[model samples]
Target: MNIRITGTGSYIPEVITKNADFDNHEFLNPDGTGFPQDNKTIIEKFKAITGIEERRYLEENLNTSDMAILAAERALENSGIDPETLDYIIVAHNYGDIKHQSFQSDTVPSIATRVKHKLRIKNPKSVGYDILFGCPGWIEGLIQAQAFIKAGMAKKCLVIGAEALSRIVDKHDRDSMIFSDGAGAVVLEETEEDGGILSHESGTFAFNEAHYIHFAKSNKTEAPDDLRYIKMNGRKIYEFALIHVPSAMKTCLENSGKSITDLKKIFIHQANEKMDEAIVKRFYKLHKMEMPKNIMPMSIKELGNSSVATIPTLYDLVLHNKIDEQKLEKGDVVMFASVGAGMNVNAMVYQH
Candidate 1:
């Protein structure tokens, strides 16, 4: 069964902070790589370390729905599908419009209802569900849509990967520098059009220690705030990507009976610009193929990592930033690789 992405969209917050503003920060260092000297210092150190020239953080009152709504609206618009005719929506977000349970009671229905009400659809019925996976969530959600559509449960589905990570990031920690709030959505519809999602196979390693990041926090004073936020083994993660990601990517391609060299555009989680260069370079060297001149990396000098939003954001960036006619083509293979805390790794192949 082929599940294709027909339309894509994303949302970035409004507030922007610059690295130069961190000049007098307490943590600002003469060398620039050092830890924040103080709360003020972190602003500078964050820019220097993450290579983020500037970043957006949502206002305190904002939530995932605020960003996701914009992203979803754009996706619907780009799909050229009347919202009235849409049949399903799957949100792959860690945060929600209201509390988690509010989806059944209010939030999710409200999101779906707004489409019908705004578009004035005569028949307004669609299934809405939430798909949650770490950074791999979007690809996983895409696969889930394929399954649902294959089962004849839906006609059109919207998958969103949104996060208000800064809300949970421990302000005092170094990892906070990379956490940001954002959302991206892919609109999928079943069609015999011959140019949508083609193949998707994904796997995850179940080791409890495979990945580690801030789990949720409880009022209980058991674990400290630092433990409740982002935790990392940056070097180990790089090592894992070099080893496991290649294996995973190959597994997906092999399972789908396709070759990596045949892919027109390779999309990996944009963890960082440096990581992007290294990972793709390593893979290219191992494959004995000339480095693909067509690779489109969306990582920027700023725009600190947005986790699951990273890949879809790359798709949006490629569509808007350049004029490369050879970049991505209809029916061409698109690859996705995601590795995050819990060491969970997922790989999938999509057809444009």
Candidate 2:
């Protein structure tokens, strides 16, 4: 009774937002103070730190659910699975269907329901729901799907991570440069495959870390408080992830009974380029091993941080050979890990 990922898909929006696009953004500090340096200097520093030169943005006519449906369609097609056979459809998202110029989220029906409807999945037993666990939502959804399969509750599940952060970003905030929009999905099924999901771990640190990433008023002094946007304490999140994410990944891998050297790839959340590298380095250090070259593949350079979409999207690209020099061969061991809002962290060990 192995729970395996049979197929993968992703929707990377066509709109490209380059770092230079922010040159005229009138960026400001959270406290409403102007930066001492010009936008050029700020953008340069941002690129150096985040390793993000550009990011994808959803077309104005589309919403998060639209992308999720697209990705889901591809995943089902890739798996050669029947939509009617799916027992669960889980959507991992933070912001729902926010219009291009609107800040309010429209989540009347869960994103999963919307995706199921759009996908034309008519099976009533195909339960649809949404989960909000920050950036780690997608991985958590995968874990949930695995649990259901393990418990004899479901045989197949569709897990999609989609977000339209561009629709909710505060253009006045410098951190907005770190966000974009995209969606990724996978088909998980009960199979007799030799390699599948091995083990997983998850945790929430809500006491003091609850507000590390939260909604807040615009950084502009005169902006209305009623209209809020995604905000975060970048320094706090960086420190927190560096200290905890590696530990969680190590635990998950160890639980899988695989040695650190058995790991061929690590699909960590595309948060910050530096933070991810440090986390993997620390993970190897925990086992007294040096980080291997090309063990980590990144999509943040072009996708930015699409919250829950990062890991699955990155995995889809690599598994499909869309990413140069990154490949996952049969029998190879891989790990998935993420950390974000909810102050949450999660990881999963899998075999290809």
Candidate 3:
């Protein structure tokens, strides 16, 4: 049951936000193209505040699915898989192209139709679906695709994770700076080859839900109300990751029968660079050994958190930047992890 990620593609909107733009706005220019003009410079204060040099977004009113469709096309093309040959499609998105998309809606899969209709995927055998999770989404989609393929139900699957954090954001809130709109797509097809997902692990600590998450307040047909939008406790998030991610990361490594020493590099959720260091520090403390020099923590800070799209975009960015030359390699373990709104925590080990 080899599931190879043969292709990777991502879409970022054209708009670029600059520090000078922020200077002119009274608020943080919730659209977020510029830095604060009155009190800050892009150099000293802005980067320190957001850890972002520049962020990207779709033009105003462009929905998430628009970005999704583009990413899907690129990934499909990159994989050399015709849309007409796709057996299944699943969308992992916090929101979609529609104004207020339904979670329970088969929109996940039906999105394939929109992709087909918009992108002209002519696959008659394709059925589309969706999954709900925040940053942990693409990993969940991969798990689902592996299940279907292993069951002999499908030959190939297009697993997409798209995010438009910009939609639910509160413009007045600085916390909103943590989000951006982007989408990523991967073509996962069954393979007889060895290098793909080797082991998977996940845990949901529901007790943390009280501090951070989203809940539906109205009928599924109704658009999300203000309260239904995503809510965050930045303090709680920092605290949760610093404490729990260490244990969870150990589990992912141990279950895969690999030690942190065996990995060439570690790629965890790029939530915050500082937070990733804390996890590495814990590993150092536990073993009385130096953390792997191969570990490089990153965040999509300028683009905000692209939610489910984070990992794939990160993966693509890594490859584009020649992560291999930087020392991530085959047979060496690559770690992927995310903690999201269900109070969920998950990590997996991959043999590159």
- Alpha-carbon TM-score of each model against the true structure: 0.79, 0.99, 0.82
Model 1 earns a TM-score of 0.79
Across 40-59, the per-residue lDDT of candidate 3 in tens digits comes to: 44334545645665567676
Off by over 4 Å in 2: none
Best by lDDT: 2
Could you tell me how far off, in angstroms, the CA of residue 74 lies in candidate 2 after the best superposition?
0.2
lDDT of 1 by residue, 131-192 (tens): 65777787788888778889988878888777766656543335556766678887888877
**Candidate 2, run of 10 with poorest lDDT:** 95-104
Each model's RMSD to truth, in Å? 5.4, 0.7, 5.5
Candidate 2 C-alpha lDDT tens digits along 67-110: 99999999999999999999999999998999888878999899
Best by the TM-score measure: 2
Candidate scoring better on TM-score of 2 and 3: 2
User: lDDT of model 3 at residue 76?
Assistant: 86
Candidate 3 residue runs with Cα over 4 Å from true position: 24-46, 98-112, 208-211, 215-229, 297-301, 322-327
At residue 266, candidate 3 shows an lDDT of 65
Per-candidate clashes come to 18, 0, 11
